[model samples]
Target chain A: QTVSPKPSRLGLCAACHGETGVAVMPGAPNLAGQRLDYLRAALKHYRDGSRDVPVMRAAIGPLSDAELDAVARWYSVQIPAAAKL
Target chain B: QTVSPKPSRLGLCAACHGETGVAVMPGAPNLAGQRLDYLRAALKHYRDGSRDVPVMRAAIGPLSDAELDAVARWYSVQIPAAAKL
Candidate 1:
């Protein structure tokens, strides 16, 4: 059996969330170094409509489950700038 | 004239946001080391109903301008664990 590769569109997330998940927009939340469980759950919530932020809903709505997990895992491991201190 | 002190109720923010703003719960976005402008704007949006997250609205709705600014400033300056790297 073959496994799928992670998505390469994470730059979409970086548009507002910053290249490192620190957020470039005023309202976007920082995602770098956050708990993997929370990041995944939040993405699922946005996708499922349980958490209804318009931008987030639209952004993650089209992603597959595996893609969501991959995105979450990507942000979870990013080294937050604050951690460097 | 005497000036009022910054609110001492930041512990309330820490309940879900973590004492250090890294978030202790799933779905709670980490706040540590985030941009000060973004943090303040997010809190204000929550308070003003523009960013309609129910829990965040309730959490920050009652704070005064100074209190809100204080909270945002506090979280802004916190050293995020990821930054230590």
Candidate 2:
């Protein structure tokens, strides 16, 4: 039996990171066009507390490995602000 | 009396944030071409502990207002990765 796909976590990311992964908040980083490996590693760092960002730690803590991968993949493909209008 | 200008703190920043302000580490954000106001605000937040990033807090804590502004100015003017080939 096939499992239903989980909902995209982009909205949660967008709350601080903006629709295109360009940050809406001052401290949040633009995730757009970042390397997929970097994104995945960052998420894992937050999840494991290796990176000390309170907001990111909270946001990434509950996500599964698949969810983290999915989020990283989504942001990696977006056009970075330098390329956008 | 004329005081000598302080050296650019870009070296400290470049330790994790590359020579051009793009991140060298997996979790560090690319600071190139970020908004000047936003960069200043982020530095202030880190200095004040309003943003809970240990490395940033340590890095920003000892800096004076002028130093923070200088660092912010330095990063805000660099070209972002999206603009580079």
DockQ-based CAPRI category assigned to the predicted complex of candidate 2: incorrect
Tens digits of per-residue lDDT, candidate 2, B9-67, equal 76788898886666788777776666677687778767777656889888876777887
Off by over 4 Å in 1: A1-7, A48-53, A82-85, B1-7, B48-55, B82-85
Q: Best candidate, DockQ-wise?
A: 1
Model 2 TM-score relative to the real fold: 0.61
Q: Which candidate number has the best lDDT? A: 1
Residue B21, model 1: Cα distance from true site in angstroms: 1.4
DockQ of each: 0.30, 0.14
Cα lDDT of model 2 by residue, A4-79, tens digit? 2433876778898776667888766776666677688768767776656788888876778887787777776665
List where candidate 2 sits over 4 angstroms from the true fold: A1-7, A25-27, A35-38, A41-62, A82-85, B1-7, B25-27, B35-38, B41-62, B82-84
- Report lDDT (CA) for all predictions: 0.72, 0.70
Maximum-TM-score candidate: 1
Q: Worst ten-residue run, lDDT, model 1 chain B?
A: B1-10
